[model samples]
Target: MSKLSLAELVSMVSETKSEGILRPTTSKDTGRYERTGLAEVVNMQITSGQFIGSRVPEPTYLPPHWSAHIHPEGQLYFCRQGSPRVVTEAYLYRPETLDKVTGWIKRIEKLIADQDFPVSAELELFIKLEDEDCAYYLTISAFLPSFRFRSSTCFARNCIGTMSNFFPMHGSLSRGTLDSLVCVFMHAICDQMTSRVSTFPYSKQDCEAFVSLLKNSRDHLSDGNIVCTVARLWGIICRNRYLTQYGQENSRLSRDQAVLWDPETKNRWVSTVASRISFRTSDRYLAQLDDVFVDHLVYSDQWKSMVTGCLRDWRGASHGAFLALMLHIFLLALTPCPSLAVASASLFVASLLASTLLLNRYVPLQGVTAEQAMDYLEAVQSPTFKFQFVALVFALPHTLNLWGTLVLFANCIFMLATNFGTGFAAGISTVALLAFIAFQWTTSDRFNLSLARTHDKFRAMFFRNPDASYTSEV
Candidate 1:
């Protein structure tokens, strides 16, 4: 206001010009400047080189098919789309860590996209924040026209390669250590082979035995050698899976047949015939058998119980048949004038003996392993094997028991006719006939009802139709 010199006048004019110009405001001055205006000012300053060393906020990046999340403790993680449970194991704190994760995702995506056919890929990554070591696993599985292809890559601190490269650090391994490793590997293989979707039907015990034989060989071998052998076994299983898938798609085999068939297709025909004959078997027995086949490891306890119960029942029936056969033979010897009654007695006696012999020969005395049981079942159900022959052999003891009792009754009636008067014999025969008819009527009604209930249950189990009715026509 008191400027009188030329310099003072110039200073005042400069101040007025500065006051007229709009000054940029900080973010705190929201009342005067909006956020957009403030952002524009900052961008202008940065472009004009006025805001030296100032960092602009970085644009966020997220992986495709995955979502990035910040944990409560400031760790970053990524979850797969629609699958929150499937998250990255590596924690992201630095830009390098994020870059590594991104690289892995890109690599797997590229691999999946490059395949000629549809396939599945799984990736696992583990990173240590404090150490330089990292581990990653990638598994790619596909079903091809000729075979199943599976590539498992593992990168660890000590080793970097496929599953075939997994070996002890030392060239040699102790027998016990090798056995343990083999057991672990075999268990994993068995789990995959025995899974619901898997077509390989070999049991865990079978895999273990096959691997154990290789381990126990006297030839000097390294850890790598044993690992290679295990890898070969895994390849075989994959090949089998491919074959089964091909058969299911190209042939008329049922799912079970496709899964359980041998390489030559003989087992397929056998399984078909067995399925047809299975309808005639006891529903409870058939159900147990199916359960064992579905998951032998899970149903092994049930199998043991079934086998023990069947053995007990068969043994008791065999004893009864043997006694009945002896009694009938004695009766035949005692009869002087052997009529058709004697012939009936003789035939029943022969049947009883045959049933007893079959029971003794075919029935196992001790409990067998699940693998053995499955083998026995497969053998019995073979196409070359006669279903009627097995049915007759198994049913003879019980069937002959009833027939033997009737034959004895007939022999007694014939003896009465020979020794006693005709009127007395006729009266006895009439009474016996009435009793037999009543017994048969009562028992047959119950049996038919039970059979109908069993049929309904079987239908419900296999057909999944609970509302359907199964009733005898009477």
Candidate 2:
């Protein structure tokens, strides 16, 4: 088929309209234009020697600087201005009728022409044409862009208002379509920022690889993968913004150091990043940044497994602590103990209470998914006081569980001494001590407490400085 230009399509559409072969319809509320009789117009054009096929060429069906591709599954994806990186949502299927195709072209042209409509820096527009009678336009802005669904009928228009319903839109759109849209959005935003800024830490190849992973493996990816992907992109954007706003001299500075350099930059950066991520509170924004940086540096599966393992260990400890606390309480009620026994029981009770409270407050009791685990890990690694406090609280359940266990052991020894004789109690205590030492030696790693090795590994993972070193007493 021969390629048709935008001018030719416009001329043909206008002629058809004049001859009454196509009737234009306008919505009073949204001022959106629609037309009917596209099939008749197409037949007339072909019969009169204007075209050769049942459908016009695909090139003629799109606006200027746009091209269309059909996926293996028949979904239509539009690329803007011949750039592979700039793509619209893959929601529309291949149009069966010329009317549907031409209708899309008109809507896209009008959307781009409207100066007030928020288009991306790359001139990317997401248009969803539904049932030949309604269309929805979505554009990326500083914040979560609202979905503007305009319909020919007032009932349809009123049913889906101008509300910012992003998650709800997901229900209507397929998973693969959403994934493609997100990948395209990230690439476009990163492309725009990289072109304008000079201090991006990640190379172009890095960003491309990330987007490729999301686009290629979207079907197999879990929700955590998508979240981490977005977080990684956000980190790059934040770092670029930081370097742009506060000179590149601060590029070497860690997040803490950079924030300290200009306290005001923190607020400004938070607001800017907030707009990009659609978060409002400073705490949530900072929390998300922690997530972004951690996800940027670590593999999703590796970190997810790490956090999941830690969560499992904590749950086990919590369960053990609960059982120990109950047994200790039962023993205390049964036996008339000395002052030492009472004090030890009280200490155990207090520790267990604090641990239980923290566990219930901070940890999820149900199955901990990778996304939830990542959130916990981020809070643990966050530098902010609020997050650090919450992390400490989360750790308390495990840490205090050990303390409560020791207290319970001491109370048990006291009960043995009060009920039996000193000789019997001493023998039992000696046996218990030996068993604990043997268990530690046999099951735990011998070099687990080597701080120097730990420091070296951490530096290798996080710090790229060649001069970085760690020293410990021999």
Candidate 3:
């Protein structure tokens, strides 16, 4: 097997983008590369289907609503040594998981915490994988998942120099990797997943998953979880590889990644060792994770971010208004262009009104009277920025020219109606004004308005605040 330093490898190839606490994968078809560092060793195979044995027709563990997006295929797997029954969750093998171990440990730790420990829980320790399935009757007591091992969860999320603490074997591969085959399997899942997210990466939905995962974990975005999650994600974005099936004599590409496998192939690496710990493991564990993936974990406050972003845009727009005010003042004092002066002054007044409305909507009354604060809280609790108003406000900024045109048409219509009695020009002018109004209505609604305020479609899409209850305007 060829040995190369990471520094040397980086010079040849590049990494893909990653989210928090996950390692970045490399560019696909960009030639073979292996990542090995201080104390980083894994038992993997670089063979033509020799190491990972044949397929099983049935799945070892199948949860309801399990999709390829979770565990590519469902079947039982045997480890190189003993092939002890492997029990795992699909999220543990999901491709977008920035840090697989972070999610995995979180899921397990929560399980451990809730359980009545020392009384063999129906759980499997990932550390061991014997050849025969159920040949070893191990209990929750057999697993040494104490709070002391929490540090290792932190270690798994970290990259490079920090990882040495987990393995601590700065040695040659000829003696084999530091961890067992099962450890290699888990790390392989992480490595495979990073490649998919990093290389062809796009959109907030792509990377925001890491944020949700970290938040949902037992640490619940604890300081260490956040830090390590960041490290792993950045590492993946920067295209870091793991040495899972590396240093093999043949040097072929490792087909161990679950992401690349077809359903049949994916199913073969199937066995997951689940605890018969109780009804919790057998019945509710899968449902609980399902809840997190579908609903609870996705619970976040998007309204806060949306409001803050809109405020920032408005603040910038305010500067433009200030400039317009100055221009109006200059024209009014120095220039002979009275029409332009009048128009500019009118614009300045309208801007001030708009700003005041926004300010009042956002800020509470300065006075500390009991009523004012209560009113403020009440206003906040009940959203005043209904979809139509939001649309109108956003549309209002771009409507200056349209309003100007409409005003000119109205003036013509008024003069004609007063003298000419609905003559040709007056009729045409009225039509023009109506057309402009129609245009504004359609354009604004297209961007921000939701016609059915009862359901609050737009607000639900863009104005969700987890803490605030939404009462429909309709």
- Best-matching candidate per TM-score: 1
Output the lDDT of residue 430, model 1: 98
**Cα lDDT for residue 100, candidate 2:** 56
| Alpha carbon lDDT of each predicted model | 0.47, 0.44, 0.34
Candidate 2 on 1-474: residue-level lDDT in tens? 344332333233333432123322222322222334243445434456565656665544555665665433333456554211134433333445434544655544553343233233422333344444433333222222221121221123333322221211110123544464456556655654556322334445655666666576456443433433443454344434533444454343332233323212333553454333322223343453344333223223333433455456556655776676577656767565545445555555554665556546434523454345545555565343323334344445455555556656766777778889788889999999999888776665764556557877788887566354333312
- Candidate 3 per-residue lDDT, tens place, 1-474, comes to 344332322222222112222122211211112323244344656498666434333443323322221111222222111112223221324343314433433433443344423212223233211111111111121112211111111111333212211111111121111122223334444544665322111224543454455334434332333333433343332222232223444321432222222222132111122212121221232332222122111111222333444455445545666676675555455444456456655655565566556656644333333334334334432132212223345334324323433343344455456556767766777687799788777677554445556447655776676226444542
Across 1-474, the per-residue lDDT of candidate 1 in tens digits comes to: 232332232222223222122121111121312223222334334556565534575666555665665433333456553211124535443568666655544443443344322332322222222133222333332222211123433223323222322211112334554455456557646675556433434455666677667567425444444534434454544534444454454532222332444333333454355444433233344444555444222233445665666556567666775676566567766764567445655555665576567656645623665556666666665345323345544545555555666666777777788788678889999998999787876677787898899987788787654554333312
Q: Please state every model's RMSD to the true fold in angstroms.
A: 29.4, 17.0, 26.7
Decreasing lDDT order of the candidates: 1, 2, 3
TM-score, cand. 3 vs. native: 0.24
* Runs with alpha carbons beyond 4 Å of true place in candidate 2: 1-104, 107-126, 130-249, 252-302, 305-309, 315-334, 338-385, 399-403, 406-474
Judged by TM-score relative to the true structure, which candidate is superior, 2 or 3?
2
Query: In terms of lDDT, which candidate is stronger, 1 or 3?
Result: 1
Which candidate gets the maximum lDDT versus the true structure? 1
